[model samples]
Target: MTRLWNAPDDFPDEMLAGFVAASGRWIRQVPGGVVRSTRDPRPTVSVVIGGGSGHYPAFGGLVGPGLAHGAAVGNPFSSPSARQVESVARAAHQGRGVLLSYGNYAGDVLHFSEAEAALRADGIDCRTVRVTDDIFSAPADRADQRRGIAGDFTVFRIAGAAAAAGLGLDAVESLASRANARTRSMGVAFSGCNLPGVDEPLFTVPDGRMAIGLGIHGEPGIAEVDLPTADGLAQLLVERLLADEEVPLPDGPSSARVVALLNGLGSVKYEELYVVYRRVAELLDVAGVVVADPHVGEYCTSFDMAGVSLTLLWLDDELERLWFTPADTPAFRTGSVRTSLPRPAAAASTERPDGPLPRASAESRQLAARIVTALDAGHAAIDAAAEELGRIDAVAGDGDHGVGMRRGTRAASHAAAAVAQRGAGASTTLNAAADAWSDKAGGTSGAIWGVILRAVGRELGDEADPTAEDLVRGLNRAVEGVTSYGKATVGDKTLVDALVPLADTFAAAVGAGADPALAWSKAAAAATRAAAATADLLPRMGRARTHGERSQGTPDPGAVSLAVLARVVEQSLSPVD
Candidate 1:
């Protein structure tokens, strides 16, 4: 239902440009995202937050005095790359240290962790707090695995306030973690959201059914139910949130104190939210819970998703004080912020590394050329199957898999081709491709692919042509790298399902003295079979897990795409016509 946009790929950049232009007084544009235009007089711990682009006010809108010092924005429904996060953190740090915070997500975790390591290497102290507060996303025993949703506001606000008060990085991070523990949220969707340039919504609900325990990124909900009246829905939301043990108060329900946020996902009207909140307030009053600053509007949103979520932040003494701290931003302003003398701007750097390329044998350079050609064939395969992949993902996911794959492969092919043209070795070309793929794609799949390429690249040195054993070893390393980082196994209904089979079969074939190309062809066939077999399995990881049953009949897009790329790579190994 997101009708207003030019090119979908360009939307994020355009939106950021307009936001900066409109909020110039409060924020300024940086390479990755936005930072405060006015700096504090004294050095203070910087609070930086970020995520995908569609969740407005969540990230950029929260940047200003007494709030986030910077935000590292990414593509729609994608986490920012490590380079982007490092750039924003560097710009925001005032020398006291930096605290990075964001919703807990697979892609966000990988990229932010990388950025944290990079900052440490540069001698800047850094820490991270991943907000995991969506109670419905995981069981109580597995609360740490829950995805962060609208409750991100509570954690971010507490961290920002702590930092603004000149608290050290440790204190700020602790408070942020505490806030995340105290917050709980759940959501429902009447319909799915349409991404810019997409012709259809990510997923759909039956005409009279509603999706319960839905994620903000258009992920299919956990369950379906008959649509309830406004008051009935409000009761449902309040009842669930109140049941959480995090809500603090006297033993009696009526004496409980809480900070409440009733958020509209996107297309839901304010009037509709207010109507629901009316019943929600009545239920809270009946239960004896006292609500503070009960916000009712869009705090975090999915583009045109007809859904809403309720966040309850249980307040202890410290949390209450931080919650009431002064804040001024493009959206959501409260209390008053003290003005401080602006710090002087740092000088800009205008230099690039002037080093010679690493030595690469002519045979290795020839192999690099073949790698470029293989990437091109892979890119073409992804392009050909993009729409089908998107459709498959729509069964239970956000339906962005095809678009993301297209972007990543295109970037990888271009980077590899460029390096190969310059007589780079296979290792150098593959490494550059890995970085480009991760940077341009900006999602879970992208990060995994980056790991895959880099692992293979490291195994194949520039000095010599990769032997069959070397290639098989690299593939094994890639499988291990992906499994370790993504926490997914062969039966997890992820790309690992296909990747593991391919790697194992190829290695087995090589061990039996088969030719590399012949072994790859057989491995590709195994991957194809495994990918198809995923249609009968239920998803056990990622957003699709919420609607596991719904995804039973559809092959995982990630698995299928990987299989397709494997087939293309096999074809690339054949002699040219």
Candidate 2:
């Protein structure tokens, strides 16, 4: 259990504050995460790496002289927002292009991809390489679908080294991709972890049993078996890794050299890891695999999870040279690195001041007040259903959907209220809410909701009163944006399942001459039915796709939350008489 925290929601921010305070030599505080406190002698490709906050050394802890230049931290178990990623990358940029790297999780991909587009639009050279190295997450034939786990260390280190060596963006990206391709990792969990303020672990292992193929986000393992001895466990891990067809041994086993990392998940102690690594070392030696660098400690961790993972990075000549480069960070350090004078304090501010509001008609301004009320109702609905939604998500996905939705809706409501109070129109108010939701929530839900609101807002221009046709068109545009951005279809067991039905129904009802309130009521009901129907769907997208069987009896949290919000919005549209 996570026993220490002022508030569950504040844990990530608090943790980041303490980390920056203690590691002043290596990092300085940025709006989203941290950046190197010292400057390089010359401009080089900046390596910006990150993910959720719980995985320490992997992200923030690795920001320094020879690793990531900056890390965009996110809420616990959630990917950082696109704004956060862009801020960190901009802070770290030194004329040279920026290289973005992180684990290949769905939320991270969505947010980072958005950030990449935004940076490019601003004339900044930004590229990305997603590490997909966990062999157990997907079959060898579908290696690109694998999750990235402890192998993040190998990819980040190599990319950072290439940048430090003054490599161009092309070379740096190629090196990072090569590292990801050669790396393979597998983890097992003896127990699951608890998020701050959560009473129960995200998932539980039965007594005397251990879970295999576990994710770092407190996701339950794909399979369970009787716990084995240290030697037996080491043997099992080595055999699986050696047999990986996705990344074949570079040469015959006798001449292959690799970097072996025995990483401990949060609660597993160092001594126990050494005991496991001892057998792991002997097994690798007997298999004719020469260990180039043997690392045994916590590199990437799930917060307080009792588990361990083994990562092997098969090295070529160039990779081995980069692998041995000196590094100095808050957590991991190797050969001594020469330091330059500390960088002067950054003068640029990340804050963007709000501009004057656009002119709006009297009717549009009145509609903006109603929008705020609807948003308030939606927030209340999400907050009330958060715990149950989290429970449902934990069955297959990382159990942070409820927390994310609460954060997003609350931020959206606040932003809407503030904008409406400033005499903004419906379109301006919705745009403010959309930006706030995405910035604060910081995940797949956040990104999708942002797209939905922004698209709808664009259709509801400030110059005129929104009619039933305008509302229907707005909904249709939202659906189009979501589908284009998220690539989710009606049966993907995501929010799209409910959102598509709601938009289609609303459009049909309005086309039949129904009033806005009547159309909304009918649409909300259709969304509710669609959400319930997701219980029978096997998730074809996102984190839940890997554990589809576990979600067989539960509706997707995203779909359910959308339905809940739809119903609440309908109530705001037409009061009970």
Most accurate candidate by lDDT = 2
lDDT of each: 0.86, 0.90
Top candidate, metric TM-score: 2
lDDT by residue for model 2 (409-457), tens? 9999999999899999889999999988998888899999999999888
lDDT of 1 at 186: 91
TM-score of each: 0.95, 0.98
RMSD in Å for all candidates = 2.2, 1.6
For residues 1-577, write the lDDT of model 1, one tens digit per residue.
9988987768888999999999987888877788888888777899999998888877899998878999989888888887678888888888888899998888899889888998999899999999888888888778888899999988889998998888888899899988888888999999999888889888889999999988877788888899999998999999988886655355745666788899999989999999999999889888877897699999999989999999888888888888898998899799988885654455112112434567898877888898999999999989889889989988888788888888899999999998788878988889889988988788788889999999988888787866777778888999999999889997879999999999999999888978778889999999999999999998898878867688998899999999999999888855111
Clashing pairs in 2: none
